[model samples]
Target: MPSVDPAASSMYTNQAYNTTRTTDATSMDKNGFLRMLTAQMSNQDPTSGQDPNQYFQTISMMTEVEQMTNVATSQTAQLSRQKDTNAQAMLGHQVSYITQDPTTGASSTATGTVASVQFDDTKGPSLTMADGKTLVDPDSVTSIQ
Candidate 1:
């Protein structure tokens, strides 16, 4: 067998075996974490096994994180539905809101009857006045009659 240089072998090992950097700068997401964990488990010395308790702890933490994420997503959807209901209830009701002139940059208070409500993913709930000209956000309404 030919003699191998230790420095070249070490460099080759680093180049071949090291984990790649993730796209995120601040933190590793779930997929990255799992890949890293799998690599560590696979490469650890078989003579002295890694602690089983550490794996259990990691699994328990991942479960808790996933559960919390699900709960938050559910709550957000619930809140959005509630807002839609509230906006719908305001239909045919007179509302007062502030408006600004496009030409002169002046603020004025205007009253209008809510003819329809629209839900936008980007802009949230908006009310269409009876006139069909003005669009008002439910949050912008100062008074509802």
Candidate 2:
């Protein structure tokens, strides 16, 4: 029978494996925890066996961790949506953005008509300029016109 070391199994199963670097929500889920628990149960030593109390404690801890992660993810998504909504409110208003001319290499400020506003999955808001250029916050915007 295959035996699993709880500590090693837990470490491998609970490892942070987020695909998106900007947020932790990408990898945080209940399935991973459940898989870890299953592995622990399957690999437990048969002679001594696993302690029921310890197993219950581990399950409880996993539940709490999963709940906490869900809460954090929800909060982050809410905050991001709020920020995007706030940015969308600026639509139709003329905004100034710092754009560099490809040829000139000098930073020139441009005030373009706000064509539209968009939000990415990770980033909050992106403003579409009348000239067809999309600008993201901090890097693309200089001031709101």
Candidate 3:
């Protein structure tokens, strides 16, 4: 009896099984796919050759995956821009945010007019008040008025 490679066998099981978790554009490039194709070709048996249709199917699946990734990235960027625009519109308007003063360390009310809104890469949004104090979370506001 001849031994079989489990990885090679799994490749033919389902198209979904081959999908890799590549969220970024760089990770889903042509070179990465070429490497995968090469690996599949190398592992295939010489006597029982892989079907040419399977090769084409794999390429089609990869193209679909890349398209889906691009769509998701575009949607995310649009959502971010919308959020920033909404935040900017809130400027000069009173907005409530749940906040605990760093100095006081007490649950007290701090209400001020909105001076400006700032968005950070990791921190999301920060609302700067007329009193020169910056509030990080929007939920920290007790009252908008």
Q: Tens-digit lDDT track for model 1 on 107-142?
A: 899999999887665455789999998899887788
Give me the candidate number with maximum lDDT.
Answer: 1
By the lDDT metric, which is better: model 1 or model 2?
1
lDDT of each: 0.79, 0.66, 0.67
Task: Report clash pairs, candidate 2.
Answer: 4-43, 95-145
| Cα RMSD for candidates in order | 18.5, 13.8, 16.7
lDDT per residue (tens digit) for residues 64-138 in model 3: 988997787777667666666666666787776666667987766556678877666544556788777666455
Report how far residue 36 has shifted in candidate 3, in Å. 2.1
Supply the global lDDT for candidate 1. Answer: 0.79
TM-score of each: 0.74, 0.56, 0.61
The runs of at least 3 residues in candidate 1 whose Cα sits more than 4 Å from the true structure, single-residue gaps closed, are 1-25, 102-106
Ranking by lDDT: 1, 3, 2
Question: How many residue-pair clashes does candidate 3 contain?
Answer: 7
Score candidate 2 by TM-score against the native.
0.56
- Tens-digit lDDT track of model 2 for 1-145: 8999854442211112345446376564567778877987889778987878998998898889878977887776676656666667767777777877789798877787777766544454677766776664634666765
